[model samples]
Target: MSFRVLRCLFQSTVSLTLLTLAIAPNSSMAQSLPYLEDPPPPPSRTSQRVRRSNPELDEYTLGPGDLVQIEIFEAPEYSGEAQVLANGMMDLPIGGRVYVEGLTIPQATDIIAAEYVRIFRYPLVSVRLSGPRPLQVTIDGEVTQPGAYVMEIPLKAQSGLQRGLQYPTVPELIELAGGVTLSADLRRVEVRRNSGNGKEPSFYIDLLSYIQSGRRGQDITLRDGDALFIPTAERIEEERVRQLAATNFAVAEDSPRSVVVVGAVNQPGNYVLIGGPSRSELRPGGLPTLTFALEQAGGIVTNADVRQVEIRRITQTGGEQIIIANLWEFLQTGDFENDPILQNGDTIVVPRTDAIDSAEVAQLANASFSASIVVYVVGEVNKAPSIRTLEVPTNTTLNQAILQAGGFTDDANRDEVDFIRLNPDGTVRQETIELDFARGIDEFENPLLRPNDIIVISRSGLARVTDTLETIFSPAPEINSFMRILETLGIVGD
Candidate 1:
């Protein structure tokens, strides 16, 4: 055979072998290959159900402090901009007070339309929530803005950045609120939502995923009145293992010693043995006192019951021991006999009290501390302040700091002004300063004052005593002694 023909014959033989293998399946091949039905292509992502807005089923409700716009078709006289009153009613021009409490915009519109029909011919009413709707969401735990944020819109991960240049994330919110303060449990973030029907469902989002993986999807959307709780990390339980490995706390390898302090304590959690004096020196055997624990837990909560305290302890042999201690008795009298010392593996539970007037106390405290050493008046200001605080530095001239504090209080005397500096170390220094208001060179040529320095304006010598009193009482007191007096008298409560 020729070389080309031989090559063609070989190719043909190879092709035939492949054809035979492709056509014929061997028993071993069939047995070796396990059958796998392709997983039914994953359930379709497209939902079939039509999206409907069910206001009644939605947990959020319309409330006061929300701005709304009302329009009455064919009855322009009744249409106007109105805010929801505290009573949940909006006064209309012709419709009187329309009860709109707990109604959505559409629902409110329908109700208003129905009411108008009784008085008018086929009255068509439309209501639109015009302002940032009031939402009762708590940006708590470790949020930058840890408070009640109005959930005007459905909160999404994208909504965070839209608010401002420095938009805060779930983690950022925690950071904004003083970075969880001191004892924030960042590992677990709890988001709780109230069902419209009164049931509350809590969802736990693990912070570790976001912190470790840099995943933004982990940041969950919050609903109105949703509560986000970042508990304190379980330090006692885990720290014990580290302590045992290091042998730092003198915790015996087998000795069962642990204590759990919950409720109203600054650090309400499990605590392990630390090789040192008890937190309270007053307690016998240097055992941690209720007061000390409470202080560590951030002081007693206003609702804490000082009378009812329970301690639960687990013994070495797996036995549980419970004791009831009166915290008030222990606090009032150094009554160690009645209130036993906390042992290792013991849990202390503080009950909530009914007589706790936390809100009233907070209001009074806020009123008392209303003095701002630094004041600023922007816009129509001649000079601006560089510093505002109670403690003005020695280098801070009154003239310069006042310029930074937003300049003289309208009728401020340029020459007759002095500033007082209260040192943290208990020294009061006074400075006689002159401001060259005429000259536009108001910039502080010398060292500017630090923050929290106090700036005071001295009246001109010709000014009367009554004028001075008027100036003194002009600004609202940050801490109103009158309010405090009323609080002490129990005449007013927050």
Candidate 2:
């Protein structure tokens, strides 16, 4: 019972009381606990995004091969479904034959249901589509894949042949066929369909317009067995014009006794020499002269050297004669005698001028400076090859050398041709030339030809591998004749 012991006990009691007060839960904490009697209500259905059950579809038109179902709840025996016939008419019980050709499924169903109400009392009718409705069309011509395609939307008489189809556009159809190749024309397209009277109606559609402009509504809708034809491009039309022109020129030039002047002239090809008393005294009346031939070939492309002119003549006595004439001297003195008349099969070569030689050397030097100069020629002519180095003569135009090796084959593009000119400074220039043979009088005066120019004569629209092979083999007769001559000379075994 000492005073110190009593004080220690009192202090320990006070500490225990403080510890119990800190650990005990208060009334506010107990009140915050969730009540078992009122658990959280099930999650509200409106909290999540709503999902649509059915997707929106475009309106449909009923046609033949479409199956429609009809049901009458009040009078089951009075209603029955039927398929539309080829005539676009469908027969229903108590509804008779109703034309549903141009009507949508809903529209056709309402018509049939209205017809049934007249027969049955308190009639409750419903129509449902049971089978696929197929709309057929035919595709022909230049499409990569041509065939009949099914139309997703049934078309009425007012619907275009272009719009009712699945593709909905000409460009889409073109894309469906794996896109246009190099040969596709795209300009001229024809849609052929049969009229109700059993006659076929042809509709011309320009795909180029539709593609250039996003006009899907203008496309023709395809129908079953409808034929679509895609023709070639405008380039082919130019070729046709050229061919016609060339043919006419050939006929006109061949009609008169023409002189064949070969070799180097500004324009060294063929010429028709006019004969007269005044000009005849210089040489035989109708013989074409080198000057005349050069005039015809466009005055000898730029670098023709007038200093040295060589003429080769094959004589009748099996003698080969050579003549050298100076055109520069003839020009200065106006000597018609020295300007010899060119005979048939005569070759007159105009040597290159010093300017041309210097230009060629400069070109070579420029080519060597860059070390990346090449030229290539493709299409129609013989020796379609590529060349390197810049030593080609500046005056050597495409026309001069195209026939020098061998002329164009049958499939050569005569009219619309492309020239890809590559400059030494890594620049490219493209020029389109018109080679119309029929209008020879106009075009022959100035034939555009340049060296290092690639003249591409596109393949004919109708050209096929078989046609190319036939063209290649067409020279068999000429080859056989040459072989016979060689055998006569005891050169080789026949």
Candidate 3:
């Protein structure tokens, strides 16, 4: 259903009534329900003093902190107002102390009326309840706070039909405990309820159905002492996570999460990731994604295996779980699941591939997770600085790096550059390459540069002779001091 339709359904009295009946414990239409599909007939709305369900825990009754007004039609002296004490006893005119806690209004009124029979031959009694005690429920797994929560009876209802009678539902219970984590799987929320027998029975609910489609019976109306557990999803997809995050069920944006990003990244270390901006107020940024971690760690290296990226997480259920992020597949098919959002304490590992394709490097260099790389451009370009360091994107070519550093100066050797690249095995590959911008990019031409590659743009023969003469006339100390001054001014970039 569209959001508008879902909101409208949640606002209707008929919807609440149907939801209540359809999810009744014994009703066959529990979690398997496609729709309301012949919901049980609504219970008669006669003055039954709020006996909504037959189950002991599900029944609504007077409790401690309740205010009750008792009336006797025939005998005015026997009528009075009483607040139930902590011990669940109320002081009445005739009954003196009657235990009314956990009893329906009419049930307690009858007990009080029987006590008044001694004062009058024919005694009629009525008891009204107000300020019903808050419902106490326990929530565990995937919620911000997984413990007992006291929820005030909310006044807002679709209509007054369910206005005074609506108890807290599963959604309200979740909100009470704080929003769910990114790992929460709303598809199979287990609500453990008192079966009235010795054993507590659990019912699995697809809460997303109710949230998205306004399906009846999916969002169980919680009762006092109900326990809800939101299990973590085994796997995730981007769109599904985004859909839930847009709702209040997901964590809020701007939340800071500390994480460790290691393996095959330029800067492999700890990082603090901030939640992305709210997609909109209605759809908060929700949670930081794996790409957010990559961005924080200075991007993946050229040999990174995007297909086998791993996120090691400490699950809400108290064990570690490893989830794979197939970014290569995501790149191919636009699957958001390949780049799932993250929770706190996640360790993202972008493993290295044994064999990397050049095309893959080109593709990932343009990915959002790509960060800058440092390359030394010495003996090059501008006359003022003979040596300069340029921080450019990974896979930036020799030509691109040169252009970014203001290109070569007028005296620079136009035909060739000395390229020195460092190998991971602690060896250097040095070569003098001929420059031809028109020939396009290739291994022998404008090859893609790696981290810490060195490029030398030697001066032309005439410029070299002029520099030799200048060096002969000038002292080495003065030139060294001038270079030192530039360093002090922070003009020679790193």
Candidate 4:
């Protein structure tokens, strides 16, 4: 072979080798391979933004049952309303399915606008919360009603506009849940606000300060999805003192102190005495005398055993010291020293006979003083209703109560009348009293009637038997009357 032919062949072989190097399957390192793993997702906005500053958007987060409207400016075909599904996504006409659950109004607008730019030159998109879900709040601990409450706000449309939200205050919500219990610790209340990212920021509130001074900044306005937790009080006495202080009472200062009057007194309630140096200033006619205390309690009744009148005083260490007074002896002998002087927080109890229960001493700390006592007169009373419940003067006697109840009927067994008394220990005491119409004032057998006394001027046995037989055989509408008669006569409880 000639040299030129050999060179040409060599060039052809070299060209073919170069072409093979260029086209025969590029190197695995030079060309990209099919990825077995998923590509990295775009950076999420939730991961980048730590906090959002929109007040209206932060007030309520997108959740199930929330209705929203998306508007694309000048593009009516794509603008429509979409409810957030339970999965937190909504399907739009062109944007398809998009997640807006944790996104605020502004963030949702940005995401929806980004998707619409492919369809329009300038997508002037806007997202609006047309209808919000029900306003719900969680109240935990020491409140009377602790649970989730749905706020019923009337969204009355005014001038073709819906009413704005009336965000409930901490106190109002507490009241709506039946108010805070007495054991609640108001010093440090917790309020947690949702940030829509599984993170809840909390703040402390001093409810006691607001209740005491009506302070402006202490009670904050609560938003939807907010939670309030009132803690339990450690010391109930201290909280009670604070409660009294909040009521404008001078519990610790020079204000008047109240004393409770209970038992057989006419009025069973509290009477106030001037505090400080004037506490001992029981004038010739003032509210500091044992007699004055009795008067404030509606006076001692005829049934009250004056020899056993007790004055219970609470010591500084919460101990009780009781002093018994024999006012009957003092009245008979005309002695002033027997009538003792009353102090602040003293309780005067005029017990009936010897039935006083020592257990009531503990209740004296919170005994309420009412202006009048209620007594029931039944059976043979002249009142049209047959049973009369009367709010009579404190310390009223049986005869006076009967007179107040329109006196007894002709068939009333006055000598065998039943006087039922309810003791503080919840046991009932009943006695049969004999009353002589001609008896003198000193010889009167009528006993004093205390609060909740039941006086039964029952008819004679003949009348009761006649009524019972009439009820069983009359086939009349007065069957209830016959049953009641039987019940009153201790016959048929069935």
Best-matching candidate per TM-score: 3
**Rank order (by TM-score, best first):** 3, 4, 1, 2
Q: Give the range of the ten consecutive residues with the poorest summed lDDT in model 4.
A: 361-370
Off by over 4 Å in 2: 1-64, 69-119, 122-132, 151-167, 183-185, 214-220, 236-494
- Deviation from native of the Cα of residue 42 in model 1, angstroms: 50
lDDT tens string, model 4, 1-494? 99999999999998986576457323432122222454423334211212334454444567766777777655678889888888998777775878888676667777776666445433566676677666689998766458998864333333332234445678767767765544566789899988667899999998777666756332377866899998766544433433523332113234344778888766678877552433343332332457656655555554566678887766433346676777766666756445665546778887876443222322221222223568899988888899899986544567777888998787777676778888768999887778655542221266555678898888977777787667556554674867765665678777
What's the lDDT for candidate 1?
A: 0.48
Sum up the clashes in candidate 4.
11
Determine the C-alpha RMSD for candidate 2 after optimal superposition of all C-alphas: 31.5
Across 1-494, the per-residue lDDT of candidate 3 in tens digits comes to: 69999878778977776677656632433322333344333222111122232232224577787777676654466667788899989888665788887787657866676555444433445665545667778999988779998877643443322325457778777776778877788899999986544678898988777757745342368876678999988865557777777776566666667889999888899887667655542222546778767877878877788889999988788767788889888878977788888777889988887675667778878887877789988885873477888888776778888888888888889899999999778999999998887765466678777788999988889997787567555656865866654554567853
Best by lDDT: 3
Clashing pairs in 3: 11-158, 238-337, 278-285
What's model 1's lDDT at 482?
Answer: 64
TM-score of 3: 0.71
The segments of candidate 1 whose C-alpha lies over 4 angstroms from its true place after superposition are: 1-60, 137-173, 181-184, 196-198, 217-219, 235-494
Candidate 2 TM-score, true structure as reference = 0.30
* Stretches of model 4 off by over 4 angstroms after superposition: 1-54, 58-60, 93-95, 152-166, 197-201, 215-219, 235-494
Q: Would you list the C-alpha lDDT of every candidate in the order shown?
A: 0.48, 0.50, 0.73, 0.63
| Candidate 3: count of backbone clashes, pairs at least 3 residues apart or interchain | 3
Give all TM-scores, in the order shown. Answer: 0.31, 0.30, 0.71, 0.41
